[model samples]
Target chain A: MKWSELFTSSVGKKWIMGLTGIFLVLFLIVHVGLNACIFAMDGGVMFNKAAHFMGSNAVPRILEIGLFAGILLHIVQGWSLELSNRAARKKGYAIPMGNKGSKWYSRSMGLLGTLLFLFLVMHIAHFWVPSRITGLDPVLIDGKEFHNLYGEMLQLFQGNLLVVILYVLGCFALAWHLLHGFQSAFRTLGLTNNRYLILVEGAGALFSILVPLVFALMPISMYMGWIK
Target chain B: MQHYNMNLTLKVWRQKNAADKGHFETYPVKNISSEMSFLEMIDVLNEQLIKEGKEPIAFDHDCREGICGMCSMYINGRPHGPWQHNTTCQLHMRAYQDGDTIVVEPWRANAFPVVKDLMVDRSAFDRIIQAGGYISVNTGNAVDANATPIEKDKADDAFAAAACIGCGACVAACKNSSAMLFVGAKVSHLALLPQGSPERKSRAVNMVAQMDKEGFGACTNTGACEAVCPKGISIENIARLNREYMMAGLTEDK
Candidate 1:
């Protein structure tokens, strides 16, 4: 097989999707951990500092380009898979098999991923764009100035119930997406042993639930005035 | 053991030939014995059709005991009927109740086109196997089975993968109609064995190339194939195949 087949062949495309999906998940881990700082409730002191460090740093600044590229590749590859898979079966069954053969989310990854993409757009517009490009209002802590992405979270979540609800809904979509995707990325990478798979699945389930739960809690806490 | 008869409403797919646009024809079957296999019920329906001077429904079946993997029917939206770990030939009529309406169709993937009625041309599988499903060995007297000194765990895993009967259920069951499970099973079965070591890399590379050439969709790891597999082949083999493909495809010296 030619080297170009890596992006063309079925297995090759999947390999790329798996590699990139896992890379994105690793980004999620960092994002979730940093976002958890909001729960500190110290007027976004630790949270703002960390967010400022990540945005200003040379390494992460460069890595952000790769992150965007990875996301685009994942979405493009996902679209092709969805289209070809739809074409594979030219006709529908007289009766549908709903969640009989696999989990609804597992088969519906295409839908779930689409929802996540929309959510990501809103999320990026809400935070990533202002923090990185347009520049957010600066707050001073310990005589140092930091772009207040955390303050934006606090104000937005408290002000708009609809946005908060959408954010929560987006988190729900993320949970379902991760539920299948976390371990699925590994499976696509060919980690088949039951011993190791048990660990991967456990971690995946925990990550799927905890990351979204904590992320959702941030908006809910701010909206409900739980956080200062 | 109790036996009973039930009448059923059968909606069967009928296609005259490869070029023909097919449609479903409903036939009401009477006195279907609960004890009879699903294929036997179809046989009864075919007999009735012959008596009525109508064309019989065409289906593929051989070695009715189920090992041949010849039976291919999407009964009531499942690859085989509702029975778990069962072939269409092994699916007994008892799975359905009286007055049930069962819709049967041929395997609906581009690669496995309808030959006629419920039978499909599965020679695409043969082509994939021909690409690299086998390992080369010199023909001679049989060596002792234990001469290879295979690990018990690896041997068990290989044997489990070998249980795949080359049936198209995996392809039929997958929403993507991916042949990954089928190819994975073949790849895993051979890749796990000592004899399979020689062609392991090329086998993964070539079989996947042929599978793609045949126009099958990619696997999404939904495990639909694993769920509907009559032999209960696991998707773990698919993971193994992915690993094999990645390693073989990337590191090839040529």
Candidate 2:
């Protein structure tokens, strides 16, 4: 089938949106859980070892590649869907206010997702690629020396207050993106019941908020000099 | 209630016939009351237009109670103005200012061609509904409502789906101009009920096929239709429709 035909199909787009969305949701949990390990440890050798483990592991390498693919697919599919919608309507009309009934986040997904994409680029350029490629020493944990990825990350976070602020702002954007996205994904995938919708939307909000809040805090703490 | 004297300009669309080129003609309506519905204000204006021996601006309206779904227009760029759940007929003159220039036009869509002035042929929706809304009921004296002991959940879902007034607002508000929500509502009503069960498989299959047959775009779950629907029909109904279609597709394979 032609590319346009696939993107414009109801069944096809739903699967694309759902499959990519579910993958990103899983990625969020794993990414946050690994970062949360930083909070559990005293900010020195122990955290460094954990970070080194996550950064250097074979499985983590595969997961990172998969996560990148997921983000790309999600973005492309979402943009295509948005474009078709715009093309369908010939004229514009006022969206009723307040009780117009859609959540504000629902209306602004495309905007927030665009901002998040920029943030993602900055995130990778600052941390993911440079740390993986450049040579770095490991902080020795209990006489064992490994790549000191955690210490490098801390140094990067502390050295730039702007990075800290941007990371927090990015987290806020992600939170808003996921607030509507999570339940909307369920609706797209055909998993809606009123009882389940209320539950899913509620749980989705908590999960979305919690992931970004926890991940963004690591940079925040380092910038504040809370951990040295 | 005191009737307040005021003058306001209306940019009304005028067309002599379907092939006739249309243009906006302004008219000044004076002495409007807050108690009058928006359409009543239009009536007052049309009454004056007729008195002057000019062609009266034509528009659609019925069941001023907001249920008939005949009153579809984009009032000041809104599908149904700024108020939620309001049809143009239900919108009160109090919602506007004395000096406001209210621009009115027919609901614009390829499927909905303008008939004349503000009235457009919404027969596209009727064609979609007729495509699959009928179920074979043996020639009938009315059956007892209690004959079918439908689960409360299913009954509620069916009632919600039945609430769709065949309003073209969903198509009007949709960015893709998708009729999925409208078709989904019909499919959902049947899929959720015992009376509809006998034809459940064919109903979804046929309704969706007809929805596509009409020049409607596909659903992308942008939720614009749900947001603007006066009835507040959730897009969840569309999701349910998807599930039913999937199951029907699988069942037909056997």
Candidate 3:
């Protein structure tokens, strides 16, 4: 069975969506936790130490691979589905209008997904790739050769108002994706009962809002010199 | 609390039959109650139409309850009109004003063809359902609901999936005219139960196949299905369907 033939199938595309979506959710958790370290360390020595450790760790490297796969699969599957849907609609030109009753997010997943993917590219280029490839100075924290990753991040944040705005917009796009994505992801994975669902939805909404809000604020805070 | 009669205007889609051309017909309805359900207000208007030597507009309805999902119409560009969860039949006249103009139309989807006026053929949904939705549980072999004693979590999940009224609101709400939410709800309903275990492999495949066969667009994972579903059916079902389908292929004894 060729991979393309398999993935192009209706069922195959769904698997790709779920697998990548769940992986991205996991990535979001790790990313959020790592970013939270900035608040604890106040964007200084402690933050730099943590960021250095993350960039140098084997686990982060492995997760980055998964992250790349998740991004690719998510985007490709979404676009493919959109294309297929468009083809089907074209075939049925004379069909009567059925019920129109979904929310803006559900219908716009592809567009939002595209925006999120674009943001991912910018994010990796600005942060992840730079942290990896650029041989920036190693900081001295408690007599150890710590990487000044946080300092480097602060440099990126400083006076780059356009970048800050783009990052903020990216967060907003990610939040919109998750607002619908989180609940739908639960439904996709067979967890759609009321007891857990209500709780899951609440958690999904909170996490979605909180995670992006916190990240988006970091750029603003850096620009304000609140965390130098 | 005093009651008063008020005049209203209606622009209703009218088709004599499936073969006839349809058009919006207007009528004046009087003495509407704020407490009356939205459907009851329509009943008043229809009665007037009948009395004025005109044919009453035909619409789909059953149960008059939110659960049956038989009542569906776009009121002023919104599915099921102003209220969020309630069906069009369950909507109250108080949601509108004395002189408000109401534009009522049938659910608009390529798969859901109009049978007449406001009653579209939702049988496309039926075909999707018929396509291997249930497990091979025979009628006589019915075990006690308590016998299986499914994990509380699983049972709750099944119940949530079961809440879908097949109302087609998700389809109406989707911009791409996708039926992912609707197909997802049915898949989730049976997939969570022990009764559905034996045939879970084929269930996802068949349902998705049937969905495509019926000319419904694929799920884009956009999250609109969950937003517009009156039952708030999750996109998780689509995810589950994906998982189930994958498991089926992997487990095939090839």
Candidate 4:
């Protein structure tokens, strides 16, 4: 096989999906952890400080490029896979097998991934744009200036019910996408041993739920004024 | 076991040929004994159709047991039937009750086009096998190759993979019509054996290329194929196949 077949072949495209998928999963951990700093209740001081560091740090700034590349490759390969898979089945079953064969979320990965992709656009536009591109409101903390991203989060969520609701829905989509993608990426890498698979499945299930729950709670907390 | 009977309404797909568009034709079959296998119940339906001067439903069934894998029927939206790890011939009527409506159809996939009623041409699977599903031998040493000591676990897994009957159930049950399970089984079955060491590099790559050439879809790791597999072929083989193909691609001898 030619080296190019690594991306062009079916299994090769899946390799792309799996490799990039696991990478993005790691990024989600960093992202949600950073966002979760809002519960510090120090009037957005901690979150702003952390956000400023992540935004300004040289290493992280460089890693951001790789993050975007991973996201783009995942989306492009996922879309191509969806199209080809659709073409493989020319006829439809009379009575569709709904969750009898596999989970509905597993079959609907393409749709869920698309949903997450759209949600990501909204999320990046609202926060990433201000903090990174357009600049956030400057707040002085501990004799240093930092971008008040938490202030932006509060401004967006507290008064606007729709934005909060949309954020919650976005997290919902992320949960479903992660539910299938977590174990799937491992399976795609041929992690077939039942012993290790059980652990990955358990950890994956917990991570998928907890990560999204934390992300959703940030908007809900700010909207409901749960945190100072 | 004291057995009863069922009068079922079967919605079977009927297509004249590969080019012919198919439709479901319902048939009421009475006095189907619960003791009879699913195929025998179908045999009753076919006999009735013959008496009524209608063309009997054409399906593929060789070994009346589960091993042949020739019996291909998508019963009630699942390949084979409702029973877990069972072929159509092994599916007994006892699972169904009287007045049940069972929908039967040919395997739906672009690669396995409908050849006739309830029978899709599965020659695509054959072509995939012909690609690299074998290992070349020196032809003088059957005993020497057989004596190679394989680890118990690897041997068991390979035997399990080798149990695949090539029924195309994996493809039929897959939403994508992906044959990864089928190809994976073939690849793992040979790759596990020391006798198959010679073609290890080429088997996975060549077979996968042929599988693509056959127009089968890519696997999405849904586990649907494993769920409906009559042989209970594990999706682990697919993971192994993925590993094998990648290793082969990266280390191919140019």
Candidate 5:
């Protein structure tokens, strides 16, 4: 096992997918938790404060670099694996068995992953670029300046039905992606024993449903004027 | 069991060699008994073809029973016909209707080039086995079966994994044509036994390397392989393979 073979081999690529996938899953928890502060009914005060801390903290800023790299590596390795898998089978069967062999989502991970990739780009453009790269308008709280990210969210979601819809759709893609990926990553990492597999799969299913649902709800709640 | 007759129209793939482009040739066989196995029906068709002075279809089969795993055919989009957990040789004509049109073809995968019609070279499997599919110990008088005690559950699991017949059905059934299930079966069978403990780490590393070198696709855990397996080889073997590979990567002395 040379250093080059680790990334070149099929099993190694799976290792990359699983490792990066778990890293992304952990990031989702922190992301959803930070975004969940909007439901506090404090007119974006708590949300903005949390967003400011996240954006300004030195530790998080450094971790953000690793996050971006993990995302790029995951996407590259995933597409390579998909392309090779496709190439392995030159021609398909005449009568295709669609869901008889495996689940629809399990077979369509590449498509789902691509959709999530596009959604991620759009999401970063809307929030990350405006907040971190170009800087956002400052809101003074306790005579301290903080980026009004919650204000930005309201402006983006309110009366902008298309953006809200896109956001919700992004969450939908994320949900399906996580549904297969969460358990799959663990399986790839070699947690295949029956007892632990059952537990991981159960936890994965719950996480897949809850995290995306909350992410989807944030935009819907904002658009419907449910949250200030 | 009730018996009946079927007049099947089989569109069997015909190819002279690996270099030749293959095509389907339709052959009608009337009054096939429901008791006849699928391969036996093919034999009947070939007999008819030979009587007519035409070239007979070439297929690979050793033992008519399922154990040899030498019989490889993709029948009607399935690796081993429509019957669940049955090999092509074990599939009976009773499963088909009176006028069923069966489309038979060879297992399609770049790693397995067709040597002839319905028979692709599966030496890639052999190469993988050669890579590390064995345990090394000095040969001597046969040790008693109970000389080294093993847990009943573990021994049973090892036997289950050992049941893989190197059939390549898993590769045929996979959407990606991946050979993980095959490799996993080999890895798990050896890794579970105390005799295989010495080379367990290197075995995982070497076999997987050989598997990749042979141009097989990565496993996506689609579970299709398990669905069509004649031996009912579990996907849990694949999980164990993954575990072994990871453990070997971490702990093996480089």
Candidate 6:
């Protein structure tokens, strides 16, 4: 098949989904790792240091461009696939068998992904845009100036119940999305060996739950005054 | 099996042609013996319609024993009807209770436009098969069966994959109307044997290319295809197809 056809074809769209999906999974690991620094509970010193390094580093900055491109490609490809799939089934069954044919989450990827996209927009507005563009309040760590993103997170989460709720809900959607997508991405990439497939599924299940739980906990912990 | 008689009201789809607007036409079928196959019951209905100077409902069926895979009908929102692991032709009237109202319709998919009534053009499946569904070998006397040793388990797996009858049930049953299960069966069947190794990579790539060109939807691993498959073909073949495609993409020369 030609390179152009690869993107145009249904199976090729799937390959794109799987590739970008796995890339985003890797990004989540780094993101969660950075966010987990708040557990130190030291007035954002360690957290701010890590955040500043990630924001300023040249390698991470270059990869950030690719990450945005990947996200855009994933969204475009996903919505196109969803729309075409819907169009393929012009009529629906009168007696709809919802869960009998497939798992709810597997069929609901489009909805979950849209929710995640909205959450990402809000997330970027809350921190990424302010810190990277308009800039944020700086704090001195080790006699050097850095953006106090941890302080920003604390201020954002402590008093705003609605934002906290939205963050947690965003994590909720993320968990469900990953529950199906984690293993599905690998399966699309042809990881079909029985033994390793089982292991991948087990690990995917754990990752889906744990990563989102930690993300949800960050805002919840801040709102409850546990992280102060 | 003991035979029993029953009455049924069937709401069957009726389309004059590819461009005609189809609608359900209800017909009463009485004294249907429990031992009669579903197609045979339809045969009775057609006979009655013809006697009444009405156009009989058009449906596709051949090799009434179910091996031909020519029978394609959606009964109560399921491909090949409600019975498990059986084609519509193999389905007996015994599965239905007396005075049942069964709704029968043609397979719905953009790629498979309805020809008339319960018959849809399944040439897309044929095109996919034509893309690379064969192994090229020099014409000669058949080689000894034992010349190339194949593992027992591998042979069994290959046989299972080879059981796909080119039926479009998997596509009809899929929510996305995806043909991955069908394509997977073909890919896995050939990829398992030594005779198919030479063109394995291109076969996977070209067949998938044709499947997409046919306008089938993407697979979401619903397992509906496996459930409705008369041959009980597993979704594991889909996984193998995915593996084969990815490997081909990686190894193929630019």
Most accurate candidate by lDDT: 1
Error of 1 at B28 (Å): 1.1
Residue pairs with colliding backbones in model 2 are: A94-B77, A138-A148
True contacts kept of each: 0.77, 0.35, 0.36, 0.70, 0.60, 0.53
**Tens-digit lDDT track for model 6 on B127-231?**
998999998777997788789999898888989999999879999888888999999999999999887889999999999988888988998776788888999
| Candidate 5 residue pairs in backbone clash | none
The deviation in Å at residue B254 for candidate 5 is 2.7
What does the lDDT come to for candidate 3? 0.75
Provide DockQ values for all models, in the order shown.
Answer: 0.75, 0.24, 0.20, 0.75, 0.68, 0.50
* Reference-based lDDT, residue A58, model 1: 96
Task: Supply the global lDDT for candidate 1.
Answer: 0.91
Rank list by DockQ: 4, 1, 5, 6, 2, 3
Which pairs of residues collide in candidate 1?
A: none
Better of 1 and 5 by lDDT: 1
Q: TM-score per candidate, in order? A: 0.97, 0.84, 0.71, 0.97, 0.97, 0.93
Candidate 6 chain A, run of 10 with poorest lDDT: A92-101
* Cα error of candidate 3 at position A55, Å: 5.4
Ranking by lDDT: 1, 5, 4, 6, 2, 3
What stretches of model 2 exceed 4 Å from their correct place? A1-8, A55-59, A94-99, A131-135, B1-7, B13-25, B62-65, B82-84, B94-101, B108-115, B136-147, B209-228, B249-254
Residue A201 error for model 2, in Å? 2.1
| TM-score: the better of candidates 1 and 3 | 1
Better of 1 and 4 by lDDT: 1
Give the least accurate 10-residue stretch of model 2 chain B, judged by summed lDDT: B245-254
lDDT of 4 by residue, B1-254 (tens): 67998789989898888788888899899999999999999898999999999999999999897887899999998888899999999999999999999999888899998899998888998998889998776667557645789998889988999999999989988889999999999999999988777898799998998888889999998889999998889998999999999889998866
Candidate 1 lDDT over A73-156, as tens digits, reads 999999888998889878667766667789999988999999999999999999988987898998999998889888899888
Comparing to the true complex, what docking class would candidate 6 get?
medium
Q: What value of lDDT does candidate 6 attain over all alpha carbons?
A: 0.89
TM-score of the B chain in each candidate versus the native B chain: 0.98, 0.93, 0.92, 0.97, 0.98, 0.97
Single-chain TM-score of chain A, each candidate: 0.96, 0.88, 0.87, 0.97, 0.98, 0.97
lDDT of 4 by residue, A1-228 (tens): 788976688888898899999999999999989888898888988788888889999999999999999999999889999999999997889977667778889999999999989988988999888888888778889888888888888888897999988888888888988899999998888875777888989989999999999999998998888985
Can you write out model 6's per-residue Cα lDDT over A1-228, one digit (the tens) per residue? 567765666776788999999999999999999989999989889899888888889999999999999999999999988889888878665545466556788889999999999999999999999989999998998899989898899899998999999999999999999999998887777775566788888989999999999999999999999998
